[model samples]
Target: MAITSANQLELLQTAEAVAREKMIDPGLVVEAMEESLARAAKSRYGAEMDIRVSIDRKTGRATFTRVRTVVEEDELENYQAEMTVEQAKQYLSEPKVGDVYTEEVPPVELGRIAAQSAKQVILQKVREAERDRQYEEFKDRAGTIINAVVKREEYGNLIVDVGAGEAILRRNDKIGRESYRPGDRIRCYIKDVRREVRGPQIFLSRTAPEFMSALFKMEVPEIYEGIIEIKAVARDPGSRAKIAVISYDNSIDPVGACVGMRGSRVQAVVNELQGEKIDIIPWNEDLPTFLVNALQPAEVTKVVLDEDAERIEVVVPEEQLSLAIGRRGQNVRLASQLTRLDIDIMTEEEESKRRQAEFEERTKLFMDTLDLDEFFAQLLVAEGFTNLEEVAYVDQDELLVIDGVDEDTAGELQARARDHLEALNKAALDRARELGAEESLISFPGLSPQMIEALAKDGVKTLEDFATCADWELAGGWTTMNGERVKDDGILEPFDMSLEEAQNLVMTARVALGWVDPDELARAEAEAAEGDAAAQEAEA
Candidate 1:
């Protein structure tokens, strides 16, 4: 509609009111109004004309203009938007070919349909501005706690009224047994903030381990002050959780600070968590020590760690096995997560039986392979000789150091060990050749003789097989005999290779076999050609 002087003032006031209500700048609202008016004006004026509208921020007075650019006579294409330089000079004293000129056009009296269209445009702009405002307000608030009142429920998700915004708490993010009614005030962690077509969506979570850590930060002054640091946290939301904390100040006990006086600090956190039991443990750099603390209230008899496998074997008293494992293995599971290690729990009885079995197996292996009697085999086993490889590789002096073994006896043992290894290698090579193992694979720089034999046994007898083998397979793969995925000790049959060594061997095989991507090879050739060309040009 036509804007009278009174209506202009009313428009400015309306724009300001909407801007304040929507938490957006007043200038943005006025700009939206200008665009809406311009869109409506296009209907009255011909749509082919370059039309623009501007609203005075203070006065709310609207101005419409028809825009045209000066161009050379030959360059003039659209008469509506471009004019000849000679024609442009008629409007100005001196006109350049690139200069723009605007002529004031009377504001159109918006008809019923045009007014409705303009109103929709303005509302859409306001909605968009509100979404942008919300996104900017909440994006940085992710990973922090926020207090909100439950506004509504849709399906299982709770819509909560956060300050100046609304957020959704999905069912999966809520504590298992917790329920909320409308208008219930609750605290939750801001898990995510996403900008969508509808608006900015703020996602809240009460089940995240970080939520528990945040609550501890809020309740424990030491953590907030940075005297005590929360190292890691593992949670079974609404059931049980464990937190590892360390103290920067030597005198301050991190666990004690978290526990608070008379258990007040921890109790505050526990109450917030819907009574989820929390175990506060002091963190140690030593993994085994930290694991012992993580499996609290369960006495650990010994901890055997396999660093390469990132696993820990925890042996406890027979009576303490259930305690260490917890009800349904929750205790060990949480400890594993907290320590970032795979944990296997066993009782003293089980460990003892395993040790005895291993001892007997080794005794038999030495007797059968080395042709040693039971007495000599037991003596070698007691001296920590586990296998033929160690016996063959150790210095002759090492053998002499064993009790009841003289220099002559050590010499005979060493000769037998060497001879046995040589005969084994000869047999393995013969078998590998029969299996069609490629000469290139056998002679590859890093593939040990034993590794070549292992490859043959595992059906990796060709260069392509060596190239295509996955890193895990090359590194001996997992131990699957027990119906569980367990780490191998890198002893793949006749060879023991480290993961790094295995990776290098695999890469070498790939390069030798030209199994790498053709595109990468092409790129490398192109790079080399360019480098050579540059060098020749420099010399010339």
Candidate 2:
């Protein structure tokens, strides 16, 4: 109860034992005891008085003190804690305001209620220290795999003991309903380590693609030693997975290294993942070449990639269609994920039909706009002319390359195409006016008549509306919703407007309407350029 010589050393001994058991610093436990004793002293010596406590680390001695501060007369509120400078003369010769005065005080005998309160305070502090230690230990361990013993299962989620703390493996994070009972040792990827109100939560996942990468790294010494790098991983969980690997040394084949001698390395990883099938493919810098490899076991005839859209079209043989698509579209889906591109697969016959359809459509457009015969239109389409604008604006030399096309015929073709385009422009302007397109937007410097008509039809009729639009809203974008990428069609996207062009047009509109200052815009752009340069330098 009291600070007697008999039990003075008991305090330090208890702090050491608790700190050792909790795997925390003994200083933290001592600090908690100091705070708990201070609270007890405050209860014993009037609650209004300021009480403090300090414990000696060596001798386990407790020192109690009462502290009061000298203050101005008007600021003197607590008589026991704060005092007027004039009244402080009894304690010191020339006490000035803002000075603290302390006197030794006797340690209090703890009542049953006070002892219980002190115990609770120490327990709370110890718990907080333990949580901090756990978070510090596991925070950097995220993104790596760990072997843990299953502690229990809650609502289909597994709680595993991970040496220092417990980690949760969510039901969705497990591999294809693979269940584990208590005391079962499981390997999982530490997906995240987060500190919360309750404690630090370590989220583990066996279904994460990184888990497969880690497994390969463990099974293949080439990967662990950095001779081979895992470039990408896509998983169908317990069913199948694809990993792309690249070797830094020319002598080593990354895929062969991962497969090991007679399939020993890959078999080890597959067994750990509940018999998940893995396709090890070589990584390539060329995305199209890599994609052909990713959709492996299925031979591709041709690959047409649209870099701007991050989409690729693969033409395969009719016999390979089913193999490329796989059951439930899993093969193509994994290939898409591995390449980070949206893939559209078609048989060679389907691709030929598509090409024929496009050719007929373009030939028809030339016939209608250029007033040419079907044979002449077919000749134009065969010469790589897809639109009337190419005919109207192309050099005469380009048209002369066509067979049986002389100078006079080329002139006639261009004249008719120009006349038709002018008529179309006039009709678009008239339609825009009918739809309430303002002159402020119509007379804008960069927008064409067709662009104005499109904007008017989409309710972006005024200059103010155009100025308020975002670049992506006008140029279209891909958005990730729930995991899959969804396309957003833009008003100006049909005109093939790029995001940068949309941004420039919108900024020009803002400047013309007195919304943006040109000088400030220049300064901001300069600062942005400087920031980019600095970042590039740092990265280099």
Q: Count the backbone clashes (under 3 Å) in each candidate.
A: 0, 0
lDDT of 2 by residue, 1-540 (tens): 787777879999999999999999999999999999999999999899999999999999999999999999998899999999888999988999989999999998999988899999999999999999999999999999899999999998999999988999999999975988899999999999999999999999999999999988899999999999999999999999999999999999898999999999999999999999999999999999999999999999999998877899999999999999999999999999999999999999999999999999998898777777899999999999889889999999999999999999999999999899999999999999999999999989888899999999999999999999999889898999999899998889988898899999999999999999999999999999999999999999
Candidate 1, position 488, lDDT: 51
Candidate 2 residue 73 Cα shift, in angstroms, is 1.5
Candidate 1 lDDT:
0.87
Quote the lDDT for 428 in model 2: 99
Give each model a TM-score: 0.89, 0.95
* lDDT, candidate 1, 117-181, per-residue tens: 99998899998898899999999999999999999899999999997789999999999999889
Q: Show where candidate 2 strays beyond 4 Å.
A: 517-540
